[model samples]
Target chain A: DTAVSQTPKYLVTQMGNDKSIKCEQNLGHDTMYWYKQDSKKFLKIMFSYNNKELIINETVPNRFSPKSPDKAHLNLHINSLELGDSAVYFCASSQGSGRVYEQFFGPGTRLTVL
Target chain B: QQQVKQSPQSLIVQKGGISIINCAYENTAFDYFPWYQQFPGKGPALLIAIRPDVSEKKEGRFTISFNKSAKQFSLHIMDSQPGDSATYFCAASYLEDDYKLSFGAGTTVTVRA
Candidate 1:
C-alpha cells in the first residue's frame, strides 16, 4: 500500500503557464508539507500545514501556493511559472507537527518549465 | 544559507566495508537530527534519527554518533552492500520550528561489490 502518493509524476510546461500538483496520504497524518529540491539536490521546505492551518511559509515567492483540504490531502499550485521553477517538488506528511515525529515522503514530481 | 552542512559530496565503499557520512549545524536550538536515504527516481526514506541528549545511537548495522559540543554528527553504515548505494541526506529541526527540517546537501554513496 502506498503511504503517500502524488499525482503527475512528470510535468513539462511552457514558461508563464500555471500548474498544480496534488498529494494524498493514507497514513492518517495531520501535518503535511511541500518541499522543493533543486538540481543540486538541495531540499528546502516551501510550506507546512497542520490541521488545515498554515504554520510555516518560508521565503518562497507568492507564485507558489499550498492548500490543504483535509488532514489527508495537500496540494500545491504555481502561477506564472518561470524557468527557475524547474525542479522536483515533494510532498510529505507526519503524524504530528513535532520534532519527534518522522515525516514520510512521497515520490517527487519533476517539473520542467520550458 | 543552508543550516546544515555536509561533507564529501560523494563516496565509494567496497562491499563489506564501512561508509561514513558527516554533518554539522550552527544552530544550537536544533534538537532533532535524522538521516534519510534516497535512490534514483525515489523519495527519501528515513534510515535513522538521533536526539541531542544522546551521544550515540546504534540500530543493527546503522549508527549515529553525535557531538553536541562540536555541533556535528556522523552516520556509519557497517558491512555496506551494493544495495546501500544511494544519496544520503542529513537534517535538523527544533520543536518550536513546527518540525521544519533544514536539510544538508546530499551525499551520494556508491557501494562497489
Candidate 2:
C-alpha cells in the first residue's frame, strides 16, 4: 500500500485560473506538509499541519491556502495562479513534530501555469 | 534567505567511483541534518541523516559527515553505480521548530557505468 498519495499527478492551467491539489497519507502520521520545488530544484516548505492545527506558515502569498480536513489529509488551493507558480508540489507526513522522525513524501504533482 | 547552502550543483562520476555532495547551514539551532535522494517525477526520499552529537554516520554505501562547529554536513556515496544517479538534497531542522525543514538547492549526480 502506498503510504502517501497525491491526486492529479500533473496539472496544467492557464494564468488567473484557480486549482487545488489533494494529498492523503495512510501512515497514521500526526503532521502533514506542503512543499514547493522550483525549477532550480530548491525545495521550500509552504505549510505544515500538526493534528489538523496550523503549525508552520511560510512567507507564501495569500493566493495559496492549505486546508487540513483531518490528520490524514492536507489539500493545497492556489488562487489566480501565475506563471511563476509552475513547479512541483510535494506532500509529506511525519509521525509527529519531532526532529527524530523522518518525513515520508508522496509522488510530486507537477503544476504548470501557462 | 536561504538557511542552507549546497555546492557543485551537478556532478558526474564513473561506476565504482565515489560521489560527494557538500552542504552548509547558518543556523546553529538546527539539530537534525538529513540527506534526501530524488529521482525524476518522484518526491525526495530520506537517504541518510545525522545529528550534531555524532560526527559521522554510515548506512550501506551512503555516509553522512557532520561538523558541529562549522555547521556543515556532507554526503558521500561509495562504489557509486549507475542506479545511484539522482538529485540529492541536504536539509536541516530544529527540534524546537516542530520539525519544519529548510532544504538546500539539490545536487544532481550522474554515475556513468
Candidate 3:
C-alpha cells in the first residue's frame, strides 16, 4: 500500500497563476507537514499541522497556505505564484509530533512557475 | 541558518568499498538524528537513526557513529553496491516541538560496480 501519496506529480503554470497540490497518507498519522525543496536541494519546512490543527508556520510568504481537512489529508495552495516558486514540494506525515517517531514522505510535486 | 551541516555534497565509490557521509549539528537541544535515502523521482525513505545517548548503532551493512560531545554523526555503508547509489540526507530534531526536522542539503552517492 502507498503509505503517503501526492497528487499532480508535476505542475507547470504561468506567473501570477494559482495552483494547489493535494496530499494523502494512509499511515494513520496525526501530524502532517509540507516542505519545500529548492534547486540547490535544500529542504525546508514550511508548515506543519497536528490533527488538523496548525502547529508550525515557518517564515514562509502568505501566498502559500496549507489546509488539513482531516488527519489523513493535507493540501497546499499557492496564490500569485512567482518564478521563485519553481521547486519540489513534499508532503510528509508522522504517527505523533514527538521526535522519536519516524516520518513517511510522499512523492514530491514538482512545481514550475514560468 | 542551516542547523544540520553535511559534508561531501557528492561521493563516488566502487563496489565493495566503504562509503562515509558526515554531518554536524549546532543545536545542542537536538537529540534525535536520522539519515534518509532518496532515489530519483521518489521521496526520501528513512534508513537509520540514532539518539544522543547511543554512541553507535549498526544494522546490516549500514552503521551510524555518533559523537555527542562533538555534536557530530556519520553514516557508513559497508560493501557499497551499485544499488546503493542515491541521495542521502541528514536531519536533526528536538523533542520540544512537534518533531520538526532540520535537514542538511544532501549527499549524492554513486556506487559503481
* Candidate 2 residue lDDT tens string, B1-113: 89999988999999999999999988898988989999988999999998899999999999999988888899999999999999999999887887688999999999999
Segments in model 3 whose C-alpha atoms lie over 4 Å from true places: none
Two-chain DockQ for each candidate model? 0.85, 0.85, 0.85
lDDT of 1 by residue, B32-69 (tens): 99999999998899999999999999999999999999
**Candidate 3 lDDT over residue span A1-114, tens digit each:** 958999999999999999999999988899999999999888899999989999999999999999999999999999999999999999999887855788899999999999
If chain B of candidate 1 is superposed on the true chain B, what is its TM-score? 0.98
Measured with C-alpha atoms, the lDDT of residue B6 in candidate 2 is: 95
lDDT of 3 by residue, B1-113 (tens): 99999988999999999999999988999989999999988888899999899999999999999999999999999999999999999999988956789999899999989
State how far residue A72 of model 3 sits from its true place (Å).
0.8
Task: Note the Cα lDDT for every prediction shown.
Answer: 0.95, 0.94, 0.93
Reference-based lDDT, residue A106, model 1 = 95
Residue A73 lDDT (model 3): 99
Task: Give the docking tier of candidate 3.
Answer: high
Where does candidate 3 clash, by residue pair?
A: none
